[model samples]
Target: MTSAFSLKRTLNLARWNAVLLTRNRLAFVYAVVLPVLPILIMLAGERGDPAVGATSITTVFLVVGLFPVYYNVLSQFVSRRDELVLKRMRTGETRDAEMIVSIALPGIVSALVISAVVVPLSQLFEQPLPVNPVLYAAAAVLAVIMFTAFAYWTAAWTRSAEAAQLTSMPIILLASLGPLGASLADSNETLARIIDATPGAAMNELVRVGWFGFDGAEATEKTLSFAETWSAAGPPLIVMAAWTIAACSLASRSMRWEPRS
Candidate 1:
């Protein structure tokens, strides 16, 4: 019955947010449809290419999982604040963490569902299963956590719900570009090093390692054992952890509870 962390209240808020999000056609399209576009395109492009590997499919899954969470969560937070929903909630029994989590729950759940679906679909397409399930789970969890923190950071500067798209673009562009840049890493070392440090690229890299048992930079058929997965996971994990800390720290400092206007 802890008021600060009431499970019942949190679940109620989450359910309400999920219902609201599903009703917004625009939000639903961006959260659910937009992310799927890239995967379809990839499936078409790689249709007969025997060179298409599990790494490529894993990258698609990463995109489907992370981008929607970032965009939808940012929009939700800003829209609620602009409507004074966040302000009203502040006067209620909801705690800060609960408020944020509730607002983010719909998008988070959508991302998770998409991530889960990606696995089975990949299997259907003949892509190899993840070599280390633990690493895959860890990467997925960390990706969501890191992006959620960055979403809050972006929301702090967003003045209105309509402006959320524009304000969230920088992070979105950075994250989107990172994976694309990583895809071309074999041809470019400098870009590889830089993109590998980015949150999105790091997440994708971890997924590649977890599923393929080899980092994207080193394409090998050798399966990574338990200790090897952790070893390969280290650098990307560090990079993601750094981004998470920086984003959360900055967001905690500047986030506003009331409408900025």
Candidate 2:
């Protein structure tokens, strides 16, 4: 095989993973049903309010990010590594980056596909199309990449596929902090900043701005044009980029090809 990364091989691996995911009932529930169920519930109660719809959109991506993008990848990588699957792949034509991306591709694609369906579904509840579609697209892509990297980094410390559940809680909660933590941290600006700095919150902020054109602090009546939306997105974009870089660095440094045990 040539030293060049093989898209064909990566795609073939991704297809296999897609099939495995569909065949495994529990994984199917985790990857597809669980991420989408709550969003549907939220949309049902939207009452034609755009804000509610926007929030539903944000929640959809956040839930998908945590479950399929982060947790599933972590568990899958750990299981594969413990099985010596990752080790075997390294001895073959699979490059490290290709192996990692292919393993993550299923969950990543699941996330994007679910988002595509749900975004349109939200419209049935009277949710308007995004005010800044660019931001939504950018946030989704960045979030998937960020969470995929974080999953690999988390797998480095995960002892087994089983242990991934326990190891994953901190990240799950952190990604989920959002405005709930904001309410809790209301008395403490420092805590609020920390919560907003999380990868999850950054992505949520992007979703909010993409849909509403203004964040919580800004006036609800305020509307920004496409260029202005980018200005408003600066902080969240910084937070996301920083987190992705940090996660990628740690994953590269500590990721394990063999079982911890």
lDDT per residue, candidate 2, 119-168, as tens digits?
A: 67776776667788778888889989999988999998999999998999
What lDDT, from 0 to 1, does candidate 1 have?
0.76
Residue 25 shift from truth in candidate 1, angstroms:
0.8
lDDT tens digits by residue: candidate 1, 1-261: 555587788889999988887799988887787666655644755543323554455555556545567878888888888888899999988898898888877777777777667777666566666778888878777788888999899988889878976887788777776557646788888878888887777887787778777645556464676578888898988998999899999999999987854
Supply the global lDDT for candidate 2. 0.82
TM-score of 1: 0.89
lDDT of 2 at 10: 94
Clashes of 2: 0
Candidate 2: stretches off by over 4 Å: 217-222
lDDT of each: 0.76, 0.82
Error of 2 at 59 (Å): 1.0
